[model samples]
Target: MRHSVRPRAAALAILLVPAVGIAATPLRIVAEDYPPFLRDTGKGLTGPYADAFRLLMRRQGVEVNYQTLPMKRVFQQVAMQPGTCALAVNYAPGEAETLIYVGKVAPITLTVYVRQTQSEPITNIEQLRSRPVGAINIAEIRDLLGTAGIAFTPVDRPALGIPMLNAGRFDAFISDTRPDVQFIGGRGRPVKAFTLARAERWVACHAAMAPATLAMLRRALREGVFAAETLPVWHSYGMDSFFLETRQQWLQPAN
Candidate 1:
């Protein structure tokens, strides 16, 4: 069942809402806790990815209350709950199809980070194999890293891994590049970066969601409804944001 939106707020919002397609009932969203993209502020959700989802869903007349959970818990909800969804899921390499993917919603650029004074810079997966690295245990990376025979420790959060990397507990940390770099800069830690893999993300729904909901989501994706809404979010964080002139003409969700 779709989660209910707050009565008074939804009532007031309905008075002001512009006309849209058939009003889908309100939904609650749970996305992975990826910072500067999707973050759990304890009070509520924030960041570019979260904000983008909110804007597009509202345009479709679907109210959303956003939250964050561990990657494991998010997928577990998708497997068990009919209306539940987990946003910001990366399309990982060699990952088995699990949930019903709703749309091509976002992108996250993954990269490797090292401490400032480290003399040896790692430029590729082969170089990282011999050294211990820190990263979240997201499935997208497992197959790629496992194939490369790389070693990594699963950190609870991306920022937590930074201090460990700086103190030499691990040789480096892998995560969405812009946010981790910002976190390190905020802490006065100088860090070096190496290009890794980039992944397209989705607002994935539980397989039990009505097929109509999934079709509606696909229409939104193909139309690029949130492209303009999310561009300024990237710029606010001082990142270069652009929509390349591809044949598809979709906005680059993230760099």
Candidate 2:
């Protein structure tokens, strides 16, 4: 016959067993067709920034699911929904308080492109004062141009801006490095020249997300796994690195 087990021994055994009920929350990430950095491969999503985000989240013990949408909708949905974040957005005026910035994953150069045949180089904002420029209908761009005293003809989409630039509808078109490169690279038409005038790209989170979640995202980006090889894809379009230099530059101080 087997001896009865001691009550304390049974209690200790129960206490030693690990809890199996907890589940990790899946991070829902929103991105657009900003290629080389974010693109749809048909098989799924693949790009330098997307890949880096995936790697970082995994290291932080977070599960991630990515969904692609139009750039404009991406921002809107993130702002309206909880448990959502958008990548590759610059610091804009009104957006500062509406979203929490995780970190700047790359330096985005907002540049002007004209036909290679054009001889004059745009070296200063003053040069654009009298000329009409093209830009996407984003508030930050409009704000930037307004602050610089540069006037622009805004287009609703980046693809439209490129063709209009080629057609000479505007004196020049303003675009950031990644989307611009992807637009030009995919186009059959030739681009005569381009030059970077400013640099600004950052990862922004929805206001609906908790402050703690934002902090976790920031920490993960700083200490998470990074692949140097993957960074070149973004560098191809003029991004310097996969992580921004400091949060201060990309984020506002807490009130």
Candidate 3:
């Protein structure tokens, strides 16, 4: 059965507002090329999370312009540009003051991937200490590793991690959960993954955004646009549990 976040009376009124009357300037969305969430496929921006965001904005009669860039650049643009937002941004202490999170997009659990030949069993974050590890060069993951007192080399992309591991660049690679790691690991280069950290990623906008615009986004999110649009994609990935668990976060607006 389909479910939506229960809305407050005020927010329900916002949702009821006519889409045609709310036509305003297009919102500029800055996104990272994170596969299965947001990707630039060389043709255009397309991904489950990105599609859901686009759908909500369209339903609200708001035009949006999307640009794909490195995750680092995505954060920079959203921080500096007014009326700009980023998709699936993990919350960080330093960035919290600079950004206003509208709602949770999805849950991202970081995993440690290693060559199948490795002997040690790594079921926790402390096991990664002293071993060579590489992770995407992003502040969120860096903060995660830093908090655990683990050091890691920063890889420019997640796709590069497996190849680098095969070349012995690092003993382990930390990345978001991906199903194709086994295929990418290939013959004689099998890979194994361990859960390291878990957290939620959100749709965050610049602090300078107009209050009305922000309200519209919050309204759409609280009304369950995230689940409505991305449910199929999550199902396709066999992650119905993730979708079910995150529905609670969607009910509450970000502070």
Q: For residue 109, give model 2's deviation from the true position in Å.
A: 0.7
- TM-score of predicted structure 1: 0.73
TM-score of candidate 3 relative to the true fold: 0.73
Steric clash pairs (candidate 3): none
170-236, model 1: which lDDT tens digit per residue?
8878865444334445543636567687666777787678887777667656533246544444444
Residue 252 displacement (Å), model 2: 22
Go through the candidates in order and give the C-alpha RMSD of each one to the true structure.
7.0, 14.4, 7.5
| Predictions in order: lDDT | 0.63, 0.61, 0.68
**C-alpha lDDT (0 to 100) for residue 184 of candidate 1:** 49
Candidate 2 local lDDT, 65-177, one digit each (tens) = 78888877877878888899877776665677677777756555566676555567766667778887887665557777888877788886666777787777877777664
Per-candidate clash tally: 0, 2, 0
Best-matching candidate per TM-score = 1
For residue 155, what is the lDDT in candidate 1? 75
Per-residue lDDT of model 3, residues 172-241, tens digit only: 8887745352234344353656777677777889998899888888876764434554455445444456
Compared to the true structure, candidate 2 yields what TM-score?
0.63
Q: lDDT score, residue 191, model 2?
A: 51
In candidate 1, which residue pairs get closer than 3 Å at backbone N, Cα or C atoms, i.e. clash?
Answer: none
* Candidate that would win on lDDT: 3
